[model samples]
Target: MTLDFSVVTDVWQSLVYGTLGTLFLAVAGMIIATIIGVLGVAILRTHMVIPSFLVTAFVEVIRNTPFLVQIYFIFFALPLAGVRLNPTMTAVLALGLNGGAYAIEIIRGGVESIPKGQTEAGLALGLHNHEVFRMIVLKPALRAIYPSLSSQFILLTLTTAICTSISAYELTSVGQRIEAETFRSFETYFTLTGIYLVISMVTMWTLAAIGRRAFNYPQR
Candidate 1:
């Protein structure tokens, strides 16, 4: 059957609003994840015993599980534990925690990739553990794994589509609503695909720029 572009066009405003929701949720979750990931990695790297093991276990469980199941756990399972969250908050927390787990591994790899000599050199220079990590190690680590981190964030954005199943009214969720109302599934989804593509591309580009500037890689 032929597609009706007009139906999709008519729904553009609603889709834009929904896309904004998707972007907001993704960006907010990513910010939280970044904080958690960095702190989690720091804890693993520095702590001597129990905290490190617990963080590692948490990371492993989050990384190994299916994200859909995690979301469901946050939304449905939590209510069973006498904790209730709105769908949006549930989606944000679940996505953030899941992404943070993956990011911890990515960032820890960067941290570990640093030369042993670098740490020794920092120590010899009278730099303490925190200073060594903060100054001598952190920038190089970020520069080393920034590309990987960016890819993960892009993947996280795409995964926001899954949030619709929880009735979060994200871009995909709104597009599904429009499709049901207009009976123009092809047009609705195709337009949605384009919007997602643009958003992902823009987000990647902006993040890459920030990464480069913040890390200040060597110029050719």
Candidate 2:
């Protein structure tokens, strides 16, 4: 068969739309993951209540298990418990929870890396505990962990392909659909691999730029 640039034009719109879906899944999950990471680490550090133990167990289990199993549990088991989430929601929840578990360790390491003297200095300055954490600790800690956190988010974006098992129809799912329709499995998947590589590289570069801008302050 002759090479067809024509096929690229034909499929460009579908690829763009599929990428949008993938971005939706990735960005939504990243937001939830950030919330969970912040709260989970805070709870673990503070040990507020029984929920702290639950969060500890939750983080451990999510970190240890495959995200595919987590997705299956969210999609399969929740309905049995009379709580049904849509496919996209299930994908986002699974990805978010999994990413959050990993992020907890990254953030915790960042937080713990702050010298005890720093915290003491903040206390001496008469800053409240929360204010100290917010002002003196968080930015430095994040600067330390930004690379790992950004990698986790980019990986989570690639893993959005797994949502196709439940019919979420993000990028990979759309590629599969196109391959089925056009009987161009090799070409379709090859194009998808290229697409994913481009997107992931762009994401990583953007994150690095953001990190540099945000964390460029002089260190003591």
Best TM-score among the predictions, by candidate number: 1
| Candidate 2 least-lDDT 10 residues | 1-10
**Cα lDDT listed for each candidate:** 0.89, 0.87
lDDT tens digits by residue: candidate 2, 1-220: 7554455558899899999999889988888988888877777767677878898888889888888888998999989999899998898888888888888888988999999899899999999988888788878899889999999999999989999999986999889888788777667887899999988998899889989999898986
TM-score of each: 0.95, 0.93
List, residue by residue over 165-211, the lDDT tens digit for candidate 1: 89997999999898888888888888999999999999999998898
The total number of steric clashes, by the backbone 3 Å criterion, in model 2 comes to: 0
Q: Estimate the lDDT of model 1.
A: 0.89
Name the runs in model 2 displaced over 4 angstroms.
1-8
Instruction: Tell me how many clashing residue pairs each candidate has.
Output: 0, 0
